[model samples]
Target: MSHTFDASVLREYDIRGIIGQTLGPDDARAIGRSFATLLREAGGETVAIGYDGRMSSPMLEHALCEGLTSGGCNVVRIGLGPTPMLYYAEASSEEIDGGIQITGSHNPPNYNGFKMVFQGRPFFGADIQKLGKIAEEGVWSSGSGEVTERDVMGAYVERLLEGLSGVDVGELADLKVGWDAGNGAAGPALERLAEKLPGEHHLLFTQVDGHFPNHHPDPTVEANLADLRALVAEKKLDFGVAFDGDGDRIGAIDGEGRVIWGDQLLMIYAEDVLKNHAGATIIADVKASRALFDHVAALGGEPLMWKTGHSLIKSKMKETGSPLAGEMSGHVFFADEYYGFDDALYAGVRLIAATARLGQSVTELREAMPAMLNTPEMRFQVDESRKFAAIAEVSERLKTSPGPDVEDVNATDGVRVTTKDGWWLLRASNTQDVLVARAESETKGGLERLMAQIDEQLSLSGLERGESVGH
Candidate 1:
C-alpha cells in the first residue's frame, strides 16, 4: 500500500506534527514501514521501539509496530520512557539493530513526533526525508516479524546513574537540589531516579500528564522556568535542573534562582571532562558564548564551534572523535564513558558529579564564570527562499568591507564575526523559516555596538533588524 506524509511533518531531526492535523496513526505506519525498509537494505532485521507519556504516543506506537513487523523486522517494544531510553535500548543490546521513540518533545499537547536511531548513530537529515520517499514508492518488504515487550526503565535509570561516577556517593545525600519535570515524559523516569539518588531532592510535576497542567515542558524559554525557580527558592535548595518534554535537552538554575544556560553548563562540564582527557577537542555550537570557547582553550583543550543542530553536532562529534559537545539549547553529548547522544538526565547527573569533584557549589560555579552581555536568540521570520541568500549576501559584504573593529569573520554555519567588543552571529534556522541573530560583548556599551553592527548588516541584506524579531 502506498502512503504519503505532510511535507511539514518531516523535519531536519525528526518527524513531528500537530496530532490529528499534521499527523496520525497512518503516518506512524508509514514511518515504521519506511524505517524497516531502510534497515533491511542495510541487512538488519531487528528493531527496538519506545514512546513517551504523550496521550497519543501509545496509539502511534501500536500502528508503527504493525508496519515494522509487516516489513520483515522483529520489533522489541521498550515501553514508555524518554527519547534517550530508546537510544539506550538500541545501543545497549546486541540483538537490536535500530530504534524509534514516539515523543512530541517540547511542543504543545496537541503535538507529537518520532526520533529515530539506526544501528548506534543518529538517523536524521536526508535520512528523514528518505522516509518520505520510501512511503511514496510502496516498496516495503513483506514478512510476519515477531514483536516482544521489554521493561527498560530500570536499566535506563542505572545507566544515567553511571554519570555520577568520579565523585563521592556519600556527598549526594548532603546535596539539596530541586527538580521540575513539568509533567512531561521525564516525569516517571525522574520519579524513579530521585528515589535512588542520594540527596534532599524535591521534585515538581513528576506526574506523567500530557496535559502539562503545571507548566510547559520547554525549559529554555525563561518564562517556563518560573515554577522551577519558585521551587528552588522556597526550599532553599542548592540548585535546580529541568528537562524538556522528551528529556533530551536540559535547563538549570543556581541556588539563587539564576538560570545556567546551556553554554555555561558546558563550561562546567568541560572543566571536569578536561581533567580526565586533557588537550581534547571540545565542541560547541556557533551560538554558544565566547567565554565558553575561551574557557575550553584555557583548560588546555582545543575548542571547535560548529553549526546549531543536535544532529549536526553529533555527526561532527563522530567525524572529529570529540569526547564532549553541546549546543546553546542544552543538548549535551558526552562520548567519554557513555553513548554519544544528548541525554539531559545524564547531564543532570554529571552536573552533580562535577560539583562534587570540583568542591564548589553550583552557585559558586556560576559566580566564577566570566560575565558578558548578550541577546537571547533573536529569530525573525524570513521567506524560506530568501533566508539563505540573505546570509550569503551578509557574509560577502563582511568579506570586502570588514566593518569597524571587525577582527575576523567565520562563515562556518552562517556568518560569525569577531571584534574587540566581542562577537555576533547571523544564521538561517534549519527547522523554521527564520533567521537567528545573537551578539555578545563585555560591557553594556560594547553590546550596543555589536547589536548596531548586526542591525547594519541586516539592513544591507534588505532586511530590517527591529522589534519584530521573535525568539
Candidate 2:
C-alpha cells in the first residue's frame, strides 16, 4: 500500500497539521519509516518514541513504532508524556540513537505534530522537508527490528525532584500552589510532583483529554489563562501555573491573579542565577522585553539577544555556555542546575523557590521590576511566504534611515530598532502566518511614538495595524 503525505504539513520546525484532515496513521507510519531510514543511513540503530496526552496519540505511536521496526530500527516506546520528557529520555538514554515526541504543543486540540531529535540535534527545517520528500517518493528501506515499551515516568519524576535540592522552598509544607495542566501531558507528572512537594496542592484538568474540553493549552495568550487565574484567586493560593499541551512552555499567575509573562519570569530566575555565576551569559530572544535584558545586565550578567525558536535558543545556550535562556513565549531553558531543555514542570519548582526565598509575593516581585510602558505581542495577518521577505525589507529600509537616536538596528532575528526612548521589534513568527511586533518605552508618549514608527514602517509593507498599545 502507498500513501501521500501533504507537503504543507512538513513545517519548518516539525510535521504538524489538523489530525484527520492532514495527518493520520498512514502519515505517521511513513514519517516513522522515513525518519528511521534517515537515522539508519546516519549510523543509527535505535530510536525513542513518546507522545502527549492527545487522544490520537496512541494510534499514531503504534503506527510509528510499526514503521520504525519495519525500517530496521529498534524502538523504545516511553508512552504518554510531555515533549521535555521525550527530550530527557533521548538525552539520558544511551539505548536510543534519536527520539521523536508526538505533541501539538500550544496549538489547538485539532492539531498534532512531531518534535524530533536526530544525532542529538534538532531534526527540523530542511530535515523536516526532506522527510516529506521521502514520503512523497514512497521509497523507504525495510528491515526487521524489535520494539520495547518502558515507563520512564518514575525516573523522570525522581530526577525533577532531585534537582530541587538547590532550591530551598522551606520544606514546602507552608507553600500553597494551584496548577492548571490544561489537560495536557503534564497532568500525570504534575500529580506526582504534587504528592512529593510539601505544599497544599490543588489541580485543575488533571485528566488527560485531547479534546481540551476546558480551555486551549496555550497559556501565553491571556484568554487561555482565565481558568488558572480564577483558580488562583478562588483558592487564595500562593501562586498558579499552567502548561501547554506538551508541557515545554509555561504560563504563570500570581496570587493576585496577575499574569507573569515569560520575560518577567526570566527576570526573577536570572536574579538568583546571576548571584552564583557572576558575569555569566544569559540569552533571551528578540521578542523578550528590554527590561529582561537590561535587568540581566544590571545584575552583572551578559545579556545576549538571539533568534526565536527552541532549537535556536538551545544551540545558543550550548555555544555561549549560558546557564539559562528563554523566549517570550514561556519556553525557559535551564542549564544551570538541570539539563538545558525547556521543562515547565521543573521551572515551576524554581519559580516557587525563588518567590519563597525573596519573602515577597510574586506580584510584589513583578511590581519591583523596572517600570517601562510596553505593548503586548501584536500580530498582523500576513502571507506566510511573504512574512520573512517583508521583515527583510523592513530591515533594509531601517538601515538607510538617518538619526543618532537610532542607536542601533539589530537584524539578528528581525528589525529591532533601538532609540533613546526605548526599543521596538518587528519579527516574522516562525510558527504561524503572522508578523509579530512589540515595543517598550520609558514613558507613555515614548511608547506611542514607538508604535507610530512601527505602524509607519508596517504600512510600507502593506500590512494593517491593530490597537495593541499599552500592555
Candidate 3:
C-alpha cells in the first residue's frame, strides 16, 4: 500500500498536524512503513517506538507498529513517556536501530506528530522528506517482523537521579522546589523523580492529560508559567521548573518570580560543565542573549551562536564537539555527562546541582547575570512563500544601506544585525508562516533604538513591525 501525506504534516522539524484532519492512523501506518523501509535498507531492523499522552497517540502508535512490522522491521514498544526517554532507549540500547516518538510536542490537544531518531542522531529536514519519497514510491520491505514491549521508565529515572551525584547531599535538605508538568506526558516520570529527589518538592498537574486543562504545555510563553510562579511564591520555594508537553523543553522561574530563560539556564549549566571541561564549546540559538555568550567566554569556554531548533542545535553540538547547548525556547542539551538530546527532566536536576555546586541560589544566579532589555520573540504572519524573500530583502538593504555602520549582520539562519545599542534579529520561522524578530540592548533608550531599526527595516520590506501575536 502507498500513502501520500498532507504537505503541511511534514514540517521542517517533524511530522505534525491537526489530528483527524491532516493526520490519522492511516498516515501513521504509512510513516511506519516508510521509516521501517528506510531502516531496513540501512541494514537495521529494530525501531524503538514511544508515545505521549495525547488522545490520538495510542491509535497512531498501533498503526505505526503495524507498518513497521509489515515493512520487515522489528519494533520495540516503550509505551507512554516523554520524548527524551525514547531517545534514551535508542542511545543506551545497542540493539535499537531507530526511534519514533509520537508526540505533538507543545502543540495543542487537537494536534499530533512524530519525532524520529535514526540510530543515535536526530532524523529531520532532508530525512523527513525522504520518508515522503519512500511512501510515494510504494516500494517497502516485504516481511513480517516482531514487536515487543519494554519498560524503561525505572532505568531512565535512575539515570536522571545519577545527575545528583555532584551535588552536596547536605544541601538537598535545605532546598525546596516546585515543579509544574502542565499535565503533559512528563507527569508519571516526574512523580517518580520527585519521590527520589533530595529536596522538598511540590508538584502541580502531574497527571498526564492531553487536554492540558491548567494551561498550555508550552513553557516558553511567559503566561503559561503563571501557575508555576504562583506555586513558588505560595510555597516560598527556592525556584520552580516546568516542562513542555513532551518533556523536552523547560520553563523556570526564580524564587523572586522572575523567569530564567533558556540562555540564562545555559549560563548556569556552562559554569558547571566548564569547571570540568574547560575550553569546551557551548552553543545557543541566535535568539539567545549576548550576555550568555559572554558568560561562556568568561568561564573559559567557546561560545557558538547557531540557528534555533532542537534538532539543528543537536546536530551543531555534535559537529563542534560541544559538550553543551540550548535554545531560547527551553531546549537544553547536555553531552557533558549524558546523551546530547534535550531532556527537561534532566535539566531540572542539573539546575539543582548547578546551584548547590556553585554555592549560589537560583535567585542569586538569576540576579548575578548581566542585565539586558529584550523584546520577547515576536512572531507575525507572513505569506509562506514571501517570508524568506522578506528576510532576504531586509538583509540586502542592511548590507548596502548608507546609514551608520549598519553594524554587523550575520545571515546564519535568518539575519541578526548587531549595532551599538545592541542586536536585532529577523528570521523566518522554520515551522510556521511567520517572521520571528527580537532585539536586545543594555538601556531602555538603546532598546528603543533597536526596535526602531527593526521597524524601519520591516517598513522597507513592506511589512509591519508586528501585529498582535499570541499563541
Candidate 4:
C-alpha cells in the first residue's frame, strides 16, 4: 500500500502541481488517506471537502472520498464551490473538525491543488510535509466512514451579506457596481450575492468556466483587471471587485478605473475595522506598501508586519488576536465578526460597506493615500537549491554593514531593508523556485535608489536580477 508522491507537488503551503505530470487521482487519494489518519489521531472524525469548478475537480473529489472513507474518516461533501465555501463549512460547524479545498487558486487552468485546514488552524508547512511522509510510509487506518452531501451555497451568500449589516439601504439605492468573477468557482456565489445586495450590479463572466475564457482569474496582476476596469468605466459604476480562481484573494477597481492594489484595499479595510475595534492590531505582509503601515498608525491602530503566505498570516492573526490582516498579493482576513480566513467574496461586501460607512466614494478613499512610486512585484527564477540560501546571503551582507541610509533590517520572513528613502524586500517565494522583490519610495529618485540597493545585494550573491518570472 506504500505510495511515493511526486516530490514537487508537496509544497510549503499546499500540495499543488501541473495536472497530468505531477498530480492526479493517486496523489489525491494518498492525501485523503493520510489526512484522515491525522485527523482521527487528533480525536477528530468528520472532515469537510469542497472543490472548485475546474474540469478535473469532480474526479479528484470522488477519489478523495474513497480514500477518506477507507480510513474511517466521515466525509461531508459540500459539492462545487470556492475554497472559502469549504472553509465556511468547517469553520461554521461544530461537527466538522477539518477541511480540504480542491482549488488551483488563480493558477492556470491545467493546474490543481489542495488547501487544508486541521482542527481550526491552517494545516501547512510542517503539517503538509508530514502528510507527504505519512503517504510514503503507507501507514493509514482502516474502516468504512460514511460520505454525505451538504448544500451551503445559499447560506454562504447570506453570510456574506452580513458584511453590509449596519449600512443604510437608502445610501445604497443608487449605487452601481461592477463585478468580474473571471469564470472561477466564485461565479455562482457572486451571482447569488449580487441579487441580494442593494444597488445596481453588472456581472462579467459569472459562469464557472474552468477554461477562463475571458481574462485570467487572478486580480493581483493589473493586466488581468483590464476587463474589470472597462466594465466599471463603461457602466459608470461606483466601483468594481474581482476574485481569484478559487475566490480567496480579492482585487478591486475604483470608480475612476484605477486599480487598487491589495495594500491600498487594506488601508480602507483597516479604517473601517479600526472604527469599531479601536487600537486593534492590523497585520500585513512585508511586501505591503509603507503607506499602509503608516495609515494604520495614523488611524491610531497598531500595525504589525509579518511574513507572506496565507497560512502564515492566519496563524499570526490567531496568535495576536488581530481583527484583520492582509497580504499585498490580495489575500485578506477578517476576524472581527467573521472567521479568520481570507475570503474575497466577503471582502467585496465589506468594500461596499466601507464606502457607505466612510461617506466617501471608493475613488476618494484611494485618492487620499500618499503617492508612492513602487515597482510591481518582481520575481526572478533561481535554482530551487539556491533560493533560500540566496536570501540568507543577502541578509548576512546587510547585517554586517547596512550602509548609512539603511534604517533597520527586519528578517521576519526574509530580509526587509528600510532606508530613509523607503523600504525594499527580497524574499524567497515559499511555493516557487524564485526570489520575489518589491521596493517602494515617495519620490522617483528614491525609488531608483531603493532598486539599486536591491541589485547591489543580488550582485553580491553572484546572481543578477535576470528576466522576470510569471506567477
Best prediction by lDDT: 4
- Give the Å error, residue 35, model 2: 1.1
Model 3 earns a TM-score of: 0.98
- For candidate 2, lDDT tens digit of each residue in 25-103? 8989999999988999999989999999888889889999888888889999999998988888888887778999998
> Whose TM-score is greatest here?
4
Clashing pairs in 4: none
User: Candidate 4's residue-wise lDDT over 1-471, tens digit each?
Assistant: 967989789898899998999989998998999999999999999999999989989989998998888989999999989999999999999999999999999889999999999999999999999998999999998889999999999999999999998899889999999999999999999999999999999999999998999988999999999998998888899899999999999999999998899999999999999999999999999999989999999999999999999999999999999999999989999999899999999999999999999999999999998888999999999999999999999999889988999999999989999999999999999989999999998899999999999999998889888899888
- Of candidate 4, the 10-residue stretch with the lowest lDDT total is 2-11
Error of 1 at 462 (Å): 1.7
Each model's backbone clash number: 0, 1, 0, 0
TM-score for each of the candidates = 0.98, 0.95, 0.98, 0.99
Which one wins by lDDT: 1 or 4?
4
* lDDT scores in order: 0.91, 0.86, 0.93, 0.94
Question: What does each candidate score in C-alpha RMSD?
Answer: 1.3, 2.4, 1.1, 0.8
Where is model 1 poorest over a 10-residue stretch in terms of lDDT? 462-471
* C-alpha RMSD of candidate 3: 1.1
Q: Comparing candidate 1 with candidate 2, which one achieves the higher TM-score?
A: 1
Better of 3 and 4 by lDDT: 4
